[model samples]
Target: MNLENAQVQMRKGILEYCILHIISRGEVYASTMLEELTAAKIMVVEGTLYPLLTRLKNSGLLDYKWVESSSGPPRKYYILTESGRQFLSQLQTTWEELQFSVNEIVAKESKGE
Candidate 1:
């Protein structure tokens, strides 16, 4: 198995969760989101992000509003909907559980169990 492939798959699995968490904080623009993701080393391009944003909106998990920008055209700012908040809460719980489980297994293995 390719190590890089496995690492990429792992990152892909949590990308949406991370995105949701970011948007949940407050209304955010796509470019701002991209900068945050890049700063955190998630390294997503605009091509990947827009489609995911659309998918989340279509699924009723997110909504956006057009904001007039002084520099140029209006920008869409993403915000989490009620359903999105509930969904994110559940995902947070699952993330904690997975973290605990994985750490426990790794700890055991490291101890030569």
Candidate 2:
């Protein structure tokens, strides 16, 4: 099996959910968002994040406002919309269920079940 590809696919599957969780904390700048994701070893580039953020915004799951920066022209800060919050709650529930299932499988395998 292609282990590396599988790992990448697994990360990609949860990336959107992680991004939403991050934004649900508060309104955040794009650069800051990139930093948090990078620090978590989830995503690396503005290129990847920008498109996802735009898509989320377009879907009415997120909203943003341009905030003037002291060192830069302006930055778009994002926040979860009402719909976004609801969607995120659902994601959290699904994530918990999936995590539990995966852990159960791992435990069974480790025990040679």
Candidate 3:
């Protein structure tokens, strides 16, 4: 199997969690979100981000409002909804548990046991 593909898939799997964390910090526009993700090495494109944003919006996990920009047309700034905040809290707990489990397994494997 392709290791690079696996790595990409792993990143994709955690994207929603990362996005929620970002939104939790504050309201964000798409370009800002893209820049943050790129800086974090997630390597996302608009094609990927827009659909995910739409899906989250439809699912009641995110909401947006248009803000006029001095440079051009209005921009949509996305923020997490109440439901989204609750869901993110749950995700955070799940992440902690999974991280602890994975670390334990990796430690054991590294010891050749």
Pairs of colliding residues, candidate 3: none
lDDT of 3 by residue, 1-113 (tens): 99989989999999999988999888899889899999999979999999999999999999999999999999999999999999999999999999999999877745546
Candidate 2: clashing residue pairs, number: 0
lDDT of each: 0.94, 0.90, 0.93
lDDT of 1: 0.94
- TM-scores of the candidates are 0.94, 0.92, 0.95
Instruction: Report model 1's TM-score to 2 decimal places.
Output: 0.94
Q: Give the alpha carbon lDDT tens digit for every residue of 1-113 in model 2.
A: 99988977888899999999999999998878788878887755878888999999999999999988899798888999999999999999999999999999877745546
TM-score between model 3 and native: 0.95
Runs with alpha carbons beyond 4 Å of true place in candidate 3? 109-113
Model 1, span 1-113: residue lDDT tens: 99988877888789899999999999999999999989988878999999999999999999999999999999999999999999999999999999999999877745546
TM for candidate 2 is 0.92
**Once model 2 is optimally superposed onto the true structure by TM-score, how far is the C-alpha of residue 76 displaced, in angstroms?**
0.4
Reference-based lDDT, residue 92, model 3: 99
